[model samples]
Structures are given as C-alpha cells and as structure tokens.
Target: MRAKAFDTKVFKRILEYTKPYQWRFNGVIVFAVSLSVFAALRPYLLKQTVDGYLKTHDAKGLLFYVTIMGIVLLMEVFSQFYFVFWANWLGQDIVKDIRIKLFKHMLSFRMKYYDNAPVGQLVTRSVSDIEAIAKIFSQGLFMITSDLMKMGVVMIFMFYMNWKLTWIVIVAMPVLVFITRIFQRKMQLAFEEVRTQIANMNTFVQERVTGMKIVQLFNREAIEADKFSQINDKHNKAWIKTILYNSIFFPIADIISSLTLGIVVLYGGIKILNGDHFTTFGDLFSYTMFIGMLFNPLRQIADKFNEMQMGMIAANRVFDILDTKDQIQDTGIIEAPIFEGNIQFKRVHFSYIENEEIIKGINLEVKAGQTIAIVGATGAGKSTIINLLNRFYEISSGTICIDGKNINEYSLSSIRKQIAVVLQDVFLFADTILNNITLNNPNISREEVILAAKKIGVHEFIMSLPNGYDYNVKERGVMLSSGQRQLIAFLRAYVSNPSILILDEATSSIDTHSEELIQRATEKITMGRTSIVIAHRLATIVNANKIVVMDKGLIVEEGSHFELLNIEGGFYKNLYYSQFLVENNS
Candidate 1:
C-alpha cells in the first residue's frame, strides 16, 4: 500500500494549475471572508434584539435594530451566493485545463508505456482523480479556511465580552482539536483504500465486459459472477470503513459542542443572578449564541478536513502519471515534404525486452519504386521491421535510412506523413465512411477521397450503401463485414497519397472473392510506389521484385520469387509449398 501522507510536490503542482485563474479564485476568497464576518454578526444582533429592545418595550428602537439586522442578513445572502458560485467556477475551470494538459501529455507517450499500463486505471486517473481535486477547491480549501476564520473572530469577541465565560468555552477546544486530528488520520487511510479498491473493481469490470462474449460462449457466466461479487464486496467494505470513521467522529464533535454550551449557560446565568456588575442578561444571551457559532464551524471544518485529505491523495495519483518519464523525446530537426522511398537497413538489431533481441544484424535495401515481399513464419521479426521503419520502436544497434539519410534525422510526423500502412487487423473509428477515409484532414478534400476510392475500385461498393459515402461504420467498424472494413482501411491509406506503402498480411482473413478484389486493388496502388508486403499467402507476393525469407532473427535467403524457388531446400521454397498444399487441400 502507498503512504497516505500529504505530498508537497503534488500539492504545489495542483496549486500551479490555478495560477491562470488566480484573479477569480482571489475574488472567491474575498467573498468567503465577508461571509464569515456577516455570519458572526447575525447572532450578536439577535442577542441585542432579545435582551435590550424586547425587555424595555421600546417599539421605535426595536424597529431600528430589526431593520439593521435585516440589512446584515441580506448582505450575508449576497456574499454567500457569490462565494459558492465563484468557488465552483474556479474549481471547474482549473480542472478543465488540467484534464486537457494531462490528455495531451498522455498522447505523447511511447507505445511501450501503454503496453504496460491498464486502460481502466488510466481512465480512473483522468476522470475520477481530477474530480476529487475539484472538490478541494470548492468544498475543502475555501470552506475550511472560512470556518477557521469565523472561529478566530468568534473567539476574540467572546474573550473581549467576558473572559471568565470564554475560559469555560475554551476548555472544550483542546478535546475537539485532538479528536479531529485522530479522525483525519484514520479517514485518510480509509479514503485511500477506497480509491484503490474502486480502481481494481473498474479494471475487473472493464476486462470482463469487453470479453463477455467469450465468457458466455464458454458458459462461465455463473463463475464470473461469483468472482465479480468478491471484488464488489471488497469495494463495499472499503467504503463502509470510511462511513464508520465518519460516524464515530461527527457525534463526538457534537457531544463536545453540547458540553461547552451547557458550561457557558450554567456559569453565565449564576453570575447574572448574583448581580455581578459586569454581567448583563444581553451579554449572557450573546455568549450562548457566540459559543454555538464557534463550535458549529469547527464541526464543519472537521468534515472539510476529510475532503482535503481525499483531494490530496487524488492529486498524488494524478501527478504520478504526469511524472512518468517513459516518453519518446522527438529531437529530429529535418523536415521531409516528400521522401524518394529509398529504404536501407544495415545490421539493425532490436529487442522489445532487454537482452532478448528479436531482430539481429539484418541488412536489406530497396530502390525508390520497388515492391519487396517478406515471407517468414511467425516470430521471425517481419512486423518488427515495419515497426522500426515507422520509428514506433527504436533500433538497438546499426542504422535504418530513407533517401540516404538516417530516418531519425527527419521529424517523426514528417516521416510518418509520407508512409501509410494497412494491417491485417484493420481498425476504423465509429464515423461516416467519408470522415473515416479523410480522417478530418483539412487538406484532403471530399473530391480527393472520392477519386482515391474509385481508383481503388471501392467507390461503387460505398455508393451502394443506404447513405452512400456518408454511411456510419459503428464502433470498431463492427457494423461492416471484415472485408468491408479492410476496403475502408485501404481507401483511408490511399487518400493520404503516401510515397511508401506497407501491407502486413492484408489479404490473410478475407474470402476468395474479397481477396481477388483486394489483390487487384493492391497491384494498382503499389504500381509506382515503394511497397513492403508481409505475406502469409504466397500467391499475393509472387510478382514482387525481390523476396526475402527470414527465420529466427536473420534473413535466410533473398532473391526474386522464382530465383528463390531454384535454391535447394530453401526456407522460402518450403513455406510457399506448405501454404500451396493447404490451399489445394481446402
């Protein structure tokens, strides 16, 4: 378990986000102070009206006092309205800016960081943790500060009026402070446990729901429900602990408050009855009200103290993510408006994990407009090569170059803009076909997208839909068939007008007819562009200008397809024959 202690760095960072809206937050603080002063005045005014005006039966004097009290009440109401409005407004605006900054920082992280992080935990940080910080500004910081100020003012006035009775009230103060400190520590631990349990529950539920189809198909619904119940029970218990602490603390505070009020009433009444010169009926009445005002805000301050602890815990969690140094630092200064598509790999080596190289000392070259097909069994680092080419992962040794310059010398966005990829598992956003293809690229007009679709032979298929190019492809493009999704992916890449193209097992999952259409489309698109194809179906890459066969982490053979077939007992020849046998048998 992590410590529940307050972190100064996290607290200071959260405060820094409020710097942009300091003027508004300062205005809220001014109103809060005014509210405290006005609230303290109300009780004093009531005591004066009851003891002075009522006993003398002076109607005009009473009217004057009542009118003054009414004006104070109105001023208090106005102050409270502005305080609440501005406090909440400041909190929400600060959170909005923080949320946007957090999201943008997340976007810049390397893929390796996400591969190790949980989706549910990240969601909890971005949404719920930020909300907790908002409460600090609105309910925790200003509210508690105002309560403390009110207590201080009330104490000063009580001492000035009658030091003897004030001393009686002061006896309860030590007990209240001691009890509040203990309650705060326990509640902080309880709140931290609650946050952890909620995050665990969210992770479990998100994973189970996403894989519900598999669970139901396997008839594990009852078993999964039992598991969920156990997690939910832990979540329930965490919250109950917080409630138990709250239940114990507030009643104790109330009891101490009642005791203080009783002592003041008993002591002050006796002084008045004994005819003490300094003691008056009105003074005693005002002391009663004063004691209540002091204790009430103390009780509120205790509650707000709990909220502050929870907010600090949330800030620590959010800052942990912000502090992560696992980011791809883009230092490349070169910009490429167009790449000639000359690619070369010289002794490139890499590992997704330390000391377990997946690509080792591989050398390859392709001319500006050549198509090279890579044929290999799984785990031969075929896809890893493409990953390095796009700079999704850095190479551990040697160099990869495009157009005779190191790929890293060019800015990441510029390099990626001139290269496009269509993977076997196509992913599409839930959006209109037109928007999905254009991807809201301001420079790529609708006419260009339509032209690309026609050139790729997918225009007729798109127009045949009910809404033509405007048809919506629902989440993950689940509304469309696998083949239709692939077509859309192709069109999306086509409209980008990339100088280099990569097709990773592109026709591996489609039916024969769909495969045929894609094959023709593939030939047309790869005609004048540099293309790299990772093929499981040997027939798709038979006409490639060069074929490379890899096994383990090294290239075993490299030549034209037919030329590789002539090599005795070659890996490519064996792979091609094995796939051909499966097709014929099927």
Candidate 2:
C-alpha cells in the first residue's frame, strides 16, 4: 500500500460542504431517532394488552389496541423513507462538488505536476475515488446510523421494562466491542489492500490499452497479458480477504448475540419461575421480542465497521489531491486584462528541476509583431524559450516582462489568453469540428470559423468530410490524419489572433504536399503577430525576419539569412551548408 499522510483537517474541509445543508441533515437524524422510538414502543404495547385488557375481553378495548399499533407502524415507515431519500441526495451532491474542485485544482498546477504524475492514477482520483466518497456517505453512513439509533433506544427501553434481562444483554457488550475493535483494525488493512489492488488493475488496463500500438510494434502482447493477469490475480486475492473478513464478522458476532439470547432467557425464566416478577407468559414473550430487536441493530453496527474503514481509505486518496497547492495561480487582488506583444528577457534563468539549469543569463528583446525563428539540435533548449514566455514554469532567477510589466504580476488567465501555442503533439476534442475550432468561445459565429479555416486552407477540405463541423473528432482526433490534425490546430490558433504565438515543431509531421498548402496559411497567420517558430527544416524558416541558433542553453548566433550565410564558419553556416548541399543534389 502507498504510504498515506492523513490530513487531520479533512473533517474540517468536509464540514464546509455539509454546512449549507445543516437543517436537512438535522431533519434526517430526527427522523432516524423517531423511528427507533416507535419500534421500541411496538412491543411494549403488546405487553399492556395481554397483561391488562385482553383477559377482560372488552369489546371497545380490542378496537383501540389494534388502531394504536397501526399508527406507530405508519410513523416508523415514513421516518425510514425520509432518511434514505435525502441522505443519498446529499451524498451525490457532495460528489459533484468534489469532482469539480479536484479538476479545477489539477488544472491549476504547474506543468511539471502532470509530467511527473501518472495519468492513470489521476484518472482514478477523479472517477473511482470520488465515487467511493459518495457510496460511503450514502448507503454506508445512513445504514450505520439507522442501526445504531435503533439499538441505543431499544436498549434504554429494555432496561426500563426488565432490569434483570437488560443486564444479561449488557454483560455481552464488552465482548462484542472487543471483537469488533479487533476485526475493525485487521479489516482496515485489508480494505486498504483492496483499494491498492484496484488502482493497480486500473493502471494496468490504461497502460496496455493506450500503448496498444507500442505493444504490437514490440511483439509484447504476451508480456502485457501476463502483467495484466498478475494484477487481476492480486485483486482477486485482496477481494477474497475482504470477503472472508466480512463472512466471519457476522457469524462471530452472531454467535455472541446468540449466547446473549440464551443467557437472557435462562436467567429471566428462572426469575419468573421463582416469582421474582410476573408469571404471565405474554410478559416473558414480549420481553424476548424486544431483546431480539435490540440485537438486530447491534449486528448491523458491527457489519458497517468494514464499510467505514474502506471509506476512510478512499477519502484519504481524494484529499491528497486537494492538499497539493497549484504552483501557478491567480490571486484576485487586482488584474490587468489587456496586453501588447512587446517582450524582454532580462538575465532569465530556469530549470524544470533543481539539479541542472537550462537557460543561463539569457537576455533578449523582441519588438511587437516581429517574426523570429529558432533552430537547434534536440535538447538544446529551443522549446524552453516559449515555456518561459507563457509562464508555464516560473523563472528561477531574473525577470520576464511583457509590455514593460513583470509577467508574474498579471493574471494567469490574462497572460495565457493572449498566447496561442501549436505544439508538435496535436490534440482535438471528441466533439464536433465546429466546437473544437471555436473551443470555449461561445460568442464566436460559424461565419468566423469558416473564415478562419479558409484562411488556413482547411475550409474546403473540412466541407469535403461527411459531417463537416458536426463530426466527432473521436478522442484526440485519432480518426484524422496527423497532417490534417496539424492543419486544424494551426487554424484554431490563428483564429484566436493571439498577441504571442509559439509554434513548436508545428509542421514537422506534415507531408510535402500539406506543408506547401500550409505555408501560405502560415504567412497569413503571422502577418502582424509576435510569432516564434521552432523548426527543424531550414528551408521552411528562411523567410523569417530573424534567426537565432542555440547550443547548450545559450544563443550562439543571431542574424538575418544573408549575414549568417556569409560567415561560413559559425554553427549556422555549417548546418545551412549541409542542408544546402542536400537540397541542390536532390
């Protein structure tokens, strides 16, 4: 099991959710107790009729007796119904709130959070763990309440009627609590094991299915099957342990209950025989019935122990996510909404981790609406430039300013809203192409979408599809070709007309034909934007107003196409000459 650090403050946090429903919650408890009282009264009424009125056979008495019992039964039924309906309503409502908060917080965390965390575990936290909180609060908590309230009240009534019989039952309370406490501790560990196994199975399923292409490519289907089978086998054994604990809990508790029943009747029977109380058979019979009712609640209380334990484990997992602070956030004290594209990097330095720095004392200035292209080998810190501009990761030293204001001083939404990014890895929603094109811009018209697509040369192609804008992208647009997906993403980014545009390997996956078509579109998109293009193919970026060559996180060269070509000795000249020869030979 993963080590869990329980926040003692979970109850305090949970209380905030229930605070709005205090009256309704109090009503639920009142109904539960009322039902218990009614149950206790039922058996007592029979004792009165048999001991007092039945022997006389009075005509009016019989009618009164039956009518009184019917009313008590009706009240009990309604009380039980009220408790079930609204408690479940509250549980599900809390689940909704929890899911929303979890997602909101998860989205706010720094990009490094997702880069390190497992996607499978995050999915479990959102779906299964949230459900666990709901299940426990609904059926498990309410049922427990019903049993405990019923048992407590019935015991009080039993003691009032017959102290001798109540004490006999009381003698068994210590043994029951002891047995329950022992099983509860052991069962808690078992429940945690079950939760761990479920998470493992989920991770196994997600990894195998998401990487089906890799598995097939490597011919590792048998290996994946064995791994999945092992997880399932562990899950089975953990579940069986839960079952065995549950199975033994009831029976062991029942034996203690049965033993109490024997002792009560034997001691009470001896007393009646000795003329200690009353000799009538009806009195003894009702007494025994009352004791049986009390035992029902006790056994139920024991059984629900395991449920509460499982709920705690689930709650801990969920709270873990809530406890993490989003490294990026907006403190709404004040915010600026409008921005221009002017950017300055003043001795900027950063690292994804503490061990090694990627950018060292890098300083540059770019006028608004200038088109700059960055070229470098892989891992030469080309993409880090864009990441810093977007404030996805904070700078470790020095400052970045946009429009002469520190970027960190601006609202997160304000800064990001003005920036558009088209990454090498393209993604689209599983919704209609129109909605995905417009994204969350509700006020955008279809005409605007069409214009944007046409400018990017994807409009005619989109119309050729069967459903056009109404078609589902099918979970990350897997149904669409890579080049096609890249084009749509580019179109979407341009439609926003953001102040700062970052294109990271945006055209690397497209074919020669698609590349030719998109180049015209790219010129239209970058016409008046502060566009930064990170490209591998030198031919695609020759027209950029400025080209910067990077090596080992420093800007090694910066110039126009002619100036860099004339040097013939720097890194850029070597790269250009090599690619230049390949192009001429072809």
What CA root-mean-square deviation does each model show from the true structure?
Answer: 1.7, 2.6
lDDT of 2: 0.79
Give TM per candidate: 0.96, 0.93
lDDT of 2 by residue, 35-89 (tens): 8888888887877777667878775786788689889989888987887887778
Estimate, for each residue in 54-86, the C-alpha lDDT of model 1 and write its tens digit. Answer: 889988889998999899999999999999899
Report model 1's TM-score to 2 decimal places: 0.96
True lDDT of residue 464, candidate 1: 86
- In model 2, the worst 10-residue window by lDDT is 2-11
Clashing pairs in 1: none
